[model samples]
Target: MTASPLLRSYDDGRLSLPNRIVMAPMTRGRADDVSAVPHPLTREYYAQRAGAGLIVTEGLWADPLGKGGPGIPGLVTDAHVAGWREVTDAVHAAGGRIFAQLWHVGRMTHPVTLPDGELPLAPSPVRIEHQQIFTKDGWLDHVTPRAMTTAEAEATIAAFAAEARNAVRAGFDGVEVHGANGYLVQQFLAENTNRRTDRFGGSLTRRLRFAVEVVEAVVAEVGAERVGLRISPDNPENEIAEEDAQGTYRTLVDTLAPLGLAYLHIIERGAYPALADLRPRWPGTLIANFNGPQPTTREAGEKVLNAGLADLFSYGRLFIANPDLPTRFAADAPLNPIRENLIYGGDAEGYTDYPALTPTPVG
Candidate 1:
């Protein structure tokens, strides 16, 4: 049988991937509750999935206030560096490359999730409607986040740059800016959440200013070769409302075209056709995460790759259960089911306990 196009070797100068399958980043809250350091089991979890061409780590908060949940890891302190260094070392030792997805949840966070009892900050004092936030206590109502001051906005940009440097120091192959899924960066892009008239809001260009600046700062710190940006393009996730997603994101891509970053990751579903609009605009390596069923089949992935829409396909829940996902795809093997209950804030049961494919004896 011929090899699947999804498993093709791709080398675009910067990222020399063994295959085109990317293990998409998912926020599995498996860190120390207080310090927000990655659990020791996290290393084993990633190491076991070394078969993936690339692994984008779960969103690691860039600062203490950036944390949006109970057990997500951070990249702020020396302890964070130490903890992540262990994961990076384990991945590299097993011949796998990984990128840290730098995240700051902005208004997506609650006071309980934050270190201090202070309100979460965002582009404006707008509360995300029709959504609930999960924290240490339990699911709680969303609150109107405090508007970030101009000085605070600038500090946030600097914080992202600092986190990029820290990620490199921890021996990460690269860093992915979490500009998607209604985080701090996306909050600045969406109209409903960003009701400010400051330089970071209002006009289309101004509303895009914060996200551009965040990417620019990170690129400046760690060279564009080691940076990637992820965007949801009007995705209503986290109750974000982007009325002009196509215009905003098209301009965003055109504006950042000269940076020559590693790649642009777009989260797409039925609501909007991402590749149809954004693919022609992006000339570099483009990764398209087609949010379909839990276990994204190889047939579905190859169809997109064969259609020439994306350079790589990212899988989330599929990788959770199938550690050797690429191998499974290669062998056309059956996959284990996911333990939905143990998906978050748990020990290695639902994590590193998933078995890899056992090698069959040669006749």
Candidate 2:
């Protein structure tokens, strides 16, 4: 059979994907509120989209302090492992593979979400302006975060390693360390957010130390082939900025090149011109996410793959609205319109109710 540009099979040494489509990690607040465990609806949600070549689950808190908002899932406790086992089982039964995205929000969290109502932690004491944390009470303005001590930073790395082991116990095929989107890992990578004179801050090399160490620890728990890292060089969200974007990311890609990771996921928002320059530096499968206010279309994804920009393309909103995205794309069928109102903090209304093309009754 002649291979289509988007539907072609791909093997990246570690992952043998049926197609070049990836369901990118997206946070839908459908977990149980208090326990932070995934509800049944979360399991059904992932099983519905199992037709994708690969599915990266929503960002899960690695510890209590990492919890970013209400209804976000965690991978810390026994209850969390039991909750995710159902999710992984359903996906595997439906002939799909999944990877858990381990996350720590750091300063992006609010004290209300913390265990003792303590201030959130960050590489520095800088506050993320113009952003609010969603709480059980309501959305509140971000508070100033306490700078993490060197000891605290080391503990955080150890926590990440523990979470990686938990992900395996939960039956995940692999784990993706969330080092992007201005969270704990990116906060350390960015010069403005990380201003310490210690090993984890100051120069570009020091700033990258946290990310490198976290990846190393995770690799120790889970082998390098079962590990992936996501990075966004130009993202300005969560009050993030770097003095030299190109130079900083070039150094990062070079440092991580020797690790032999499964893949590298990069979220490109067009603001960073370094994607073209940085793509060739790393010799591994690259998953490029075209991110912005606008939704990514199949044609746009094909363009990136056709131009050799990325080995695979990841979609967010499209996969949310159409569970059977691959078949729909193959037949040029109509797509379900995304319900903007019900994107987050909702029930099965927007999560699992979207219908696929019904098969005709066989005579």
Candidate 3:
């Protein structure tokens, strides 16, 4: 694969990338809640993928009340910091730069996942339809959420900012706000989900306030160059809307334009057109996740890079399969297949078992 000049090192603001491939943050519930720490397996997991130019860790909960599932990790305590430090140290030692992805489930929660069986809060009191969330016992469907008052919204932003401070202390190089996939922040961004008549909802600019505030607050805690925002403009998972997709995201992207964030990650699916328009609309780095369940092939990634559709491309399953994904792409080597089952729960069976390719002996 030929390296496009566009794929060369990226350095403008405080952001820097030696290559154009980033390992997208993936959730593998391998943390121990008793200690609330990242397991040794988690350390090995990141170390294996150190070849990617950049790695984004699975979403780390900002507060226990915001946790969505069992076995998820958090950045609220000292133990959590130490555990994450191990993961970051391992990544750095193996020549990788990593960022912690901050998350809050918002209404995508159940009583079982909360600290004391409290109902999760949302912009409105509406219950999500046909959505399942992980609990300490098992999977439970989402419940009707209580609407947050002005005070609650202010508290939520402070929580996110606190987590940003913790992320840097945890030794992560940066942080990505998990404002996608219909989670807490994205829930506010979608008008259909956000029915509040207050300043947080009602209008496009109002609906976009939560997401922008999260980014702005986190950037204030950290630096704009160390912050990235992820969005899935049209995905309806968790009963989110695809309506007004263009208007919603244009407001978001343009609002964030002046912040000069490290990158804007848009998961490709129902928002390709909107994402394409963002290339010129956004002055900072833009990362486009390739379409499809299967990982983007080297050819496809190269096409995206050469065309300048994105400043970088983020890969999920491919990074799982090829720990040395950057080298594999560089050498045009065949990739190992990843087991889908191990993609979520379980131990290291398929998690850290994938091996890098070694050259065959000449006969």
Candidate 4:
């Protein structure tokens, strides 16, 4: 059989991607909870999966207050920086390119995870209902978050900028702003979560201001060519609701189009045809992902590629189960099943212990 297009090299003048298969970010809660630092095995886990064209690491909190749960790795303290540096070095030594995903869970956080039991900060006092936040103690009811003062919001933007620099210092090739998955950025975008009347919210432009500013600040710290943004327009994950999903996201993409970003990674499982609409609108590289009960398969990604909808495609759970994902895709090798119970808060039993069929090429 001929080699699939998914395995072909892509050089777009900016990102010289070796293949279209991107190892999407998946949060594996295995960090040092108290220190918010990654363990040594984290390095081996990443290095073992270096066959992917690019690896967008699991979301890490840029600020101490940005942490959403236990074992969430951080870039805030010096210890955090050193821990991540080792992970980056391992991936690099294996000849792989990696991007740090800067994340802030915002109101998804519980007071139990916060400093001194302070309320989580969000665009407004909105809290997610129906779902509860899982903490170290146990499952806790989502509490109403404190509305972030305008000054605090500005400071948060700077914190992302600072961490972008920190990621570079740790040897990351680029940084992706985690604007998707109903986190802080999406909270500001969604009308139900953002009830602020200040410049950060109220209208379309205002609603997108926080996300746009965060991206711009990070781009300034790094370069536009080294920055990427992820978004899930109509995805109601974490109880987020966007009344005008199309308009809200259209304006956001159009606004950020001219910045010459490295790429725009989007989750395509929204209620609307978000990927179909935004693919043509975005002028830069486009990375597409589909979310569901099962892990993303090569067949699903091929459909997107054949439709001319995306330049790259990403896999989440598949990467976790099969460390040599690109090689397995090439050989049509059977993949290892994911251990649901050992996915989070575990040792090497589920993480670095996953066996690879054979060694994969670095590039």
Candidate 5:
């Protein structure tokens, strides 16, 4: 039978996806407090959502200093690798593909979240204004970050490459660099956030240096075919600001086009009209995330795909409440509403307990 557009299989011969629906990465904060290993519930959580064509795990910090907040998972130690193996095994057993999202939050964190109560690291000593980070103590105002020296910046790149190797060892199908949402990579990309006179800052090309280096290192560690990138241009989240969102992202995307990566995931809201102009420039598959206020529905996804805007559609909150999302979309079944309070740091209550579509009573 011919499949619906959303249900069509995507086999670029490198990344084989059963459908066009993807599960976007979201931080659930359910990892172990001390070790930063994924809790047992995390294993069950991904196993439940295995119906997604591709499941991108929550941001996994590459090292201790780069950690964002309490309970965020890490890929720095043997324990972390062992813990993630179970998750990947479960997803594969359930006939699903999964990817690890490598992340470094830079200055989007507080002392409580860092080791030895050290200051957060960034390209410059800029403190994100009017922002607070959750900690073991409580939400604390962000502190001025210490500018990373050239040596430290290069070391961070090496850490990302090392984590990519660890992700492969943990049995993930591929890896997605989390260069979005005002995190470390995005901090380097935005002009206002990066104010150095070095090779890693100043001009647009210099500002994009960190992201390109990290991607190159990961591509070297894992083949380019097994890697992907996520970016949100001009997004002001986490106090990020860009003077020229369109020009900067255009150059960045153009630079990345020749890498022969798996796909480019772009988070778009209606405000960024330039996103449309940037979409066609990417030669590989494009995953467009409708990050607006409204939930992404079948109609919206179909419209984008029909218009040749994106090859895959990524859903976040909806996927949180609907594990068998693809099946429900195919049947036009009712979706479960997300429990707002239970989204952050919860157990199975909001993570894995959402019921899938069940049969109605026989008359």
Candidate 6:
């Protein structure tokens, strides 16, 4: 079978690959709760799906305050680092490359999820529109978060920088900053969420300050070649909506363009225009998330390759059910059905139970 340009090598020197299909970062909530480390089973789980050209590990909390819910793993302590080392080593032993997705949930978290019911942080002290959050004390309505002061905001940037350092030390091939899905960084970028009047708010450039600063910090710590940024222009997951959608993200992409970052992972949203528009502006690799109908079918993936919309394709739910997803995609075989009920906060039920395709029985 002929390979599409989507399977071509990345111009960025940070990641080497035989194809361009990537196993997107997914949250499995299988961490060692007491120690805040990855469960041993988690290592075997990722090792099972080592066939993808690249695998982006689930979001790992950078600090304790960044925790969104119970069971989410972290990279804060020596134990966390040691636990993740096993995971990365397993992937490497299987001849697969992976990147650690550094993340923070911001106000999407509940006070109970925190150490002592401490208020979550946000750019403004506004409560988000009716949204329920999972906490240690069960589900609860999200409360108005405490507005971060300039000092606190700067310190938060430091915390993210430290997390990037921790990720490298934890034996990851590279790092991807979780800037999508209405998290802390997305909250700051969205006008409706960020109501501050300081350098981090008010104007487009100011609103994008947090994301730019985070990327700059990571670039400084580990070089831009190893840093990737994930952004979704029209995501409504955490009630994120920007008054000026296209203008805001265009500026966001253009500003980071000069940095020569590894890749821009764009989660496709209908409100946003064709990703091809952002292509000429960003010289680095472009990875698109297929969210809507038609999905990223082999035909559609090939079309994207021919049209040059993205350099790589990020498979989300498909990665969940098919550990050998790349091979299945190549062979055009039937996929293992995903059990939605077992998507999150479980043991090895849906997390690692998915089976790879086997040869049929002889007649």
TM-score of each: 0.98, 0.97, 0.94, 0.98, 0.97, 0.94
Model 4 agreement with the true structure over 28-75: per-residue lDDT tens digits:
989988899997799999999989999999999988779999888998
lDDT tens per residue, model 3, 202-232? 8888888988999999999999988999988
How far residue 89's Cα lies from its native spot in candidate 3, in Å, is: 1.3
lDDT of each: 0.91, 0.90, 0.83, 0.92, 0.90, 0.83
Give each prediction's root-mean-square deviation over alpha carbons: 1.1, 1.5, 2.0, 2.3, 1.7, 2.1
Better of 1 and 5 by lDDT: 1
Question: Which of 4 and 5 is the better model by TM-score?
Answer: 4
Q: How many backbone clashes does candidate 1 have?
A: 0
Candidate 2 worst ten-residue window by lDDT: 1-10
Q: How many residue pairs of model 5 clash at the backbone?
A: 0
**How do the residues 1-363 of candidate 5 rate in per-residue lDDT, one tens digit apiece?**
334688988888787888999999999998987899999988889998999999999999997989998889999899999999999999999999999999999998888888889999999999988868899888888899999998999999999999999999999999999999899999899887899889899988999999999999999999999899999887778888877888888999999999999999988853566558788799898897877676777778878888888889889989999999999988888899988899888678988899998977899
What does candidate 6's lDDT look like per residue over 235-332, in tens digits? 77778876776888889998999998888998877566637667777888888876664435656666776788888888888888888887776677
**Lowest lDDT 10-residue stretch of candidate 4:** 1-10
Pairs of colliding residues, candidate 6: none
Each candidate's clash count: 0, 0, 0, 0, 0, 0
Query: lDDT of candidate 2?
Result: 0.90
Among all candidates shown, the one with the greatest lDDT: 4
TM-score, model 3 to reference:
0.94
As for lDDT, the candidate ahead, 1 or 3, is 1
Model 6: CA > 4 A from native: 1-12, 293-298, 359-363
Stronger candidate by lDDT (2 vs 4): 4
**How much is 81 displaced in model 3, in angstroms?**
0.9
Residues 62-115 of candidate 1 have per-residue lDDT tens digits of 888899988999998999999999999999999999999999999999998886
